[model samples]
Target: MKVLLLGSGGREHALAWKLAQSPRLTTLFALPGNPGIARYARCLEGIPLTDHDAIVTVCGAEDIDLVVVGPEAPLVDGIADRLTAEGIPVFGPKQVAAQLEGSKLFTKELCKAHNIPTAAFGRFAEPAGARAFIEAQGAPIVLKADGLMAGKGVIVAMTLDEALAAVDEVFAMGVPGTEILIEEFLEGEEVSFFCLVDGETVLPFGSAQDHKRAFDGDQGPNTGGMGAYSPAPVFTPEIERRTLAEIVKPTARALADAEAEFRGVLFAGLMITSAGPKLIEYNVRFGDPECQVLLRRLDGDLLALLEATANGRLAGHDVTFRDDAALAIVMATRGYPGDYGKGSVIAGLDEADAVEGVTVFHAGTRLIGDRLTAHGGRVLNITALGTDVREARARAYEAVSLIDWPEGFCRTDIAWRALKL
Candidate 1:
């Protein structure tokens, strides 16, 4: 079977690596894929990823059997809708259904309408209204932009001054002045839970804890994700059961009733609070860095699993994972999620990959002649698998140590919480 993967990042690179491993795959292509992805698939860099018509034409010309979307941007832009309209099987939700991630306000309203447990939130169209809500909600509030902001849209304001400033900053983005979400902050460790749903039956995939804060000890602005580890200790069996019953299932059911019939990976960002697992937000696609570690632990044919979910025949199929733990350390350009230089030559990738159980997934990189240069904020992800979190974390860091990039920086503590066990 031929497949076409979408997006260009560590997540798509991991997906490409896993999909290429499937014996059933005969050919693979990536749309605007990065240098790392080029090793495993034919990358079409000339065409833009968001050009739906061009992508549909490529699928037709290449005789693509399945289209797997890796990022929320294209899916939210309705690329899946165009592909499915042309009779191509897509492993992503339609644009209408993708509002689950496209709009923070939309999901919050959905949770309220369906009685899904989430942080209390209020939508605002004016700065005054938002400020008023923040004043009422008090400090330590969570403020989010209505639409996607490259994962940096949400801000946790710990003080009234910060809350007011956040409101001004979000409004100043030139986004719809009326587009913002002010909610009461929910305290606890956050977990990234992935579920494959076919608008009917749901298939549980796996879970990972994502470190959103950019610096060590969780004190800094949020990037897409700094690092991650799988099988989060906080999301126990009981908590998983409760999350599915109270959050995942209900949301799926609600989407179905609303005629959305979600057909893709439901990335439920949850907060394990004192009450239970509460929904923080949804991504509607795989999480970067998390995908690097999660796919490393997967123990089945990824192609078959995705096809089943796309075809809505998940009843007979089951997804499994290795007992071993996995960890991913993100090696990013210095001063990431802010002003930073690009095109710095990167070195020692082979040495990094030579480390046992480590696979380096590229994010923001480009091949200039023979040299690999940094191209984005988060550059490469060094992921590893081991008997436990400690080993996995050690292997991941050891590989990080091998990379020779003076312009790059990474957190020394990737999975600090899980290393305790």
Candidate 2:
């Protein structure tokens, strides 16, 4: 099958890598794909994802069988709806359904109305109301901007001053009619649960734990994700059962009832609390760094599964993952999740991938002549597979050591929760 994958991040590179391995895949193409993705698919550079008409033209020219969206922005922007209108099959939720990620208040309200377990939240259109709510909520509260901020919009304020300041900061961005969501911070271990929903059928698609903090020991500010490991040890069978029954299934049912039937992946950000698994938030597509590991352990035909989901033929289909564990360590420009310089020459990628069970997925990189240079934060994902999380972590770090980029840095402890190291 001919496929056109969207986005230009490590997640898209992983998807391209997996799709390229499928025997049924005839041609794989990527839009503004990274250097790592270019190895597996034809990279169509220059066309922005926002140009929906251009994407449709590419699909028609290539006779694309499926268009798999790797990022949430396009889906939230109604790219799937536009493609479907042109009779193109897309593996992503439409605009209405994508509100689950586009707006934090939307998910919170859905949880409240459906009785789905989640943190108590209050939405405010103005700053005074948000500040008043924050004062009432006290310290250790969570403040989230209504729209997307590339995963850095939410702030876990540990003090009253911080909480109030966060509100001001969000409003200072000056997005017209911007709303802030103040949520009661729930204490627990967080895990990402994924499922493929083709309007009605919900197929479990494995789980992973993401390191949102940029530094080791879970310190520093939140980022897109520094690193991740698949088959989260904390997400046990019992927890999985409760999550699906109480959260995932109910969410799908509620969306269906609301006439916003969803297709494609539902990435649930869950907090395993004393009561049970509670909804933290949701992403319409796959998670970066997390996807790098999950796809490394998948043991099925990715192209076929996605095509089936796009066509609404996922009723009886299920995916299988290798028993082996997969871990990914994100190597970023030294000042990542903040201001970082670009165009720093990087070397030794070939040697890093030569490490047994290791594959380095590029994120913010560009191949300049014969040199690979950093172009963005969270530049490379050194992913590896092993019998367990510990071995996977070792292999991933080993690959990290081989990379010759002085400007890059990665967290030394990726699966610390699982290994307790």
Q: Which ten residues in a row have the lowest lDDT in candidate 1?
A: 170-179
As a whole number from 0 to 100, the lDDT of residue 49 in candidate 1 is 74
Clashes of each: 1, 0
- Model 1 Cα lDDT, one tens digit per residue, 224-320: 9999999898889999899999999999999999889899999999999999999999989999988888899999899998998888888888888
The C-alpha TM-scores of every prediction are 0.98, 0.98
| Cα-based lDDT for every prediction | 0.90, 0.92
lDDT of 2 by residue, 1-421 (tens): 8999998899999999999999999999999898888989999988999999999999999999899999999998999999999999999999999999998888999999999999998988899999999998799999888877778888899999998988888776436787788899999999999999998899999999999999999999889999999999989999999999999999999999989989999999999999989999999999998889999999989988899889989988879999999999999998888899999999999999999999899898998998999999999999999999989989989999989999999899899999997
Residue 300, candidate 2: C-alpha displacement in angstroms: 1.3
Error of 1 at 71 (Å): 0.9
